[model samples]
Target chain A: MRRLLLAGPDFSLAAVDPHSTPGFDGGKKKGAAALADGGEVLSSLQEKLFAESRAGSEIAVLLVLQGMDTSGKGGIVRHVVGLVDPQGVQHHAFKAPSEEERRHSFLWRIRHQLPRPGMIGVFDRSHYEDVLIHRVRGLSPAEEIEKRYGAIRRFEAEVAASGTRVLKVMLHIGRDEQKARLAERLERKDKYWKYNPGDVDERGYWDQYQEAYQRAVERTSTPEAPWFVVPAERKWYARLAVQRLLTATLEDMQLSWPRATFDVEAEKQRLAAT
Target chain B: MRRLLLAGPDFSLAAVDPHSTPGFDGGKKKGAAALADGGEVLSSLQEKLFAESRAGSEIAVLLVLQGMDTSGKGGIVRHVVGLVDPQGVQHHAFKAPSEEERRHSFLWRIRHQLPRPGMIGVFDRSHYEDVLIHRVRGLSPAEEIEKRYGAIRRFEAEVAASGTRVLKVMLHIGRDEQKARLAERLERKDKYWKYNPGDVDERGYWDQYQEAYQRAVERTSTPEAPWFVVPAERKWYARLAVQRLLTATLEDMQLSWPRATFDVEAEKQRLAAT
Candidate 1:
């Protein structure tokens, strides 16, 4: 999965097929079964991570999701991270910066939302927006846009050094798939709230957005915080692959429950009398 | 369920049997199945509540869970609230106050954690702790403690008036059940971190704590924000009851999908062209 999805030196978004389910040969039925199976594993690992936090362990995990409209970023959050204890999960969705937010450095708002120890933090859209949208729409100067890549690299490196594992995923979906999704939203009254007219304007910049994503992934996919471009045209595959990525990242942490801080036997005796 | 669980004018903590499942007739097997089924209904209601928020709906739900240690408050958070999209749930587990927190009003920290518009807020332990622990442990003067009940009553009244429904629940567990839970924690290495030695000390004051709870519930149970004393000895019953309470509260809101602000047909035509 890593070999297929991880953005390498020669990685290009155009080369990866959004419809392909790499590494997993299973069809939809097997993918659904695997996802259900993965939920239990993810929940247990998350609990251990949370338990370790009680012992003052500084470890945490951050998942940064970047993608176009209808790329299933919200789906990954709902289907994947939803399997764990909500108490231990810190989920944030970054919209356009508020007036107060724009007053600070781009990383300032991002820094404020980093997970506390022993949490799995998820960003629906994150710091990459500073480079992606800014570059695609000329929201920032050429030199300024050029510098955020190094800034993000340094920021993520510091985050890793502080015991937070950063997992960055970009959900890759085809233009046709996006149009279908937007049309479905438009057609369904229940989905109308999610149907934004601005999304159609953004669709016109599909190639520019793709170029922006390719550049962003190329510049900032570091060893500490590598980017995984998941094929997201098939929603099930996208959800399953991200779940595997998250579960595997947690497994690699190798966390265990913190030992009792007090004398267990004595506490047992005391508890009995109570 | 409402009639069976709601705290009324004649409510008494001692009269309510913690072992009895008042509204639910089924045993553990049926209870588990019911909980699983309820997750689907709860998830749908929660999503509607969230979607409504996007279109400027001020509606929200605040679940305040207050109980003795080992009363399965965390279990409800994991099994019940965990069923919903974490994106729409604001969960805050209040520990003992920090030096800074102590400097402000008890409600200060609580106001900060209240759910934003169109969110479900869960407080693992809530402002009720001020009355329960403070009265039991004499953490505050009798006069000041007396004043806080009215303060909380008025505060919740304003909270409800502003479009947030507050559901206060006290997880009622017998002393023996708490002792068994604490002993189990000490018995397992994986559970050791949850075994706080101070919990045994707290158990010594169980009767006083119950009296504190009785008085708090009596004083604060109002029409706007009623308290529900959930018999929590059966973990499954407690979880199912809370899920029902949350689902019912959300259903009462009668939220519908926000109408599209844009011209759907025009947007569809534009989207197709793009």
Candidate 2:
């Protein structure tokens, strides 16, 4: 069964297969080309969206990116969203629980970081970690973990109802690819320190975590907050797919600048006096 | 009198050419080569600093960027700090006061955005705005503003004393260059909306603002938080200067990754069992 939909009338999986197995290497090359193309498209789209949002002052965009280590989350952000006006974009990366964050529910830290109207907020990792890390580490009981998934869906639904359009992406990288990246980091002395022994411990649960992610993606993906299982083996393809998703989402909203009553000519003349 | 200092042992204004001007034609031909060189150096330095901060586990960096309109705060941010690990970098842009913000003291919102330990926080326009905007708009009495300046200096000194290195930059663009940018924005249909008629109104007070900025730089800049009046007429030069400043500052700190006590081989073997 097809889990995600690509752009246009065609629901063909060709757009999604570029990061899958046999075509992985070729997929990487093609993904790079797609990123270049998608990057240009997204840049133009983002500018238009920014202008309309600033002008109309109605809609806001919240881009939620969740992925495992080396899953190309940062790469997607750098290439696809880098062109937007910094003043209009806010990026928050949620890390290990702070004292204040641990004192509250998992969602508290993220709530304050939501974008205001007419702005874009990108979350590098989000509340989904409550399920991902807690489940993997046994931080919560099994029943409680299941319950939180329902809570998350409802929480996200409420957010959608409140004028924010959410784009959630889960970057999926294969075990072999993850191993290769880990090895590459070890090979370079400069990056050796970035490699944590704990990550290797996590890798032991590769299959279990993959199954966990698959279940999460299937269960949590909804019309209002669909999850894009972006294959991260090919970084370029992952970025392009995310960018295309973002552009399509923004276009669907059909945002435009708000109308103002200021007189342009008179204001220009007034400014010239200064 | 020299108001800004380059970060080096042989710091001298004589090393900088006052008459040098770089054009912004949007073509990659003009200052692209120089910008690229500066970008490469900045990226390498940023990478090293990030690695070190992650290892130290307690150090933080607060990068404060302030400038007039079109002084390339966005450009410098895009180029200089663009390559750092997004997970470790937090960017905050301060805008004109929202109703809620106006209800509190000016520094209320800013204090909340300071960098957490082992992270880098970039402030586009910061507490300095209180002095700049309040003075420009006459929102506060002269004595109150003066007192705030001293308070700011002390606040920053305390932050520096507390392991957060503060680096402030004032992007200095020429009056004529600013007019050219304003003209280009007005001419382009896509950018016309960005041209608020009030920008021209503010242009009349360009000299007054310049004097105000000069005074602010002279009075507040100290050993704990030195200011760099980067020449902004040339966007590449300004970015390069900022990159150099950041690189030098990070180098002075001699940062290294924190030592971790995990056995990678054992962890790998443990993971292999799963």
Individual DockQ of the candidates? 0.90, 0.31
> How many angstroms is residue B226 displaced in model 2 relative to the true structure, after the best TM-score fit?
1.6
lDDT of 2 at A132: 83
Clashes of each: 0, 9
Deviation in angstroms for A273 in model 2?
A: 4.2
The residue ranges of model 2 lying beyond 4 angstroms of the native Cα positions read A1-27, A78-88, A96-103, A255-261, A272-274, B1-30, B83-85, B98-106, B257-260, B268-274
RMSD of each predicted structure: 0.7, 4.8
Q: Show the colliding residue pairs in model 2.
A: A55-A257, A55-A258, A56-A257, A56-A258, A271-B200, A271-B201, A274-B204, B55-B257, B55-B258
Candidate 2, residue B252: lDDT: 73
> TM-score of B chain for each model?
0.99, 0.84
Give the distance in Å from residue A101's predicted Cα in candidate 2 to where it truly belongs.
3.7
lDDT of 2 by residue, B160-250 (tens): 9888889998787777777777767655667766777667767877767766676677677788988776767767667656766776777
**TM-score for predicted model 1 compared with the true structure:** 0.99
- Stretches of candidate 1 exceeding 4 Å from the true structure: none
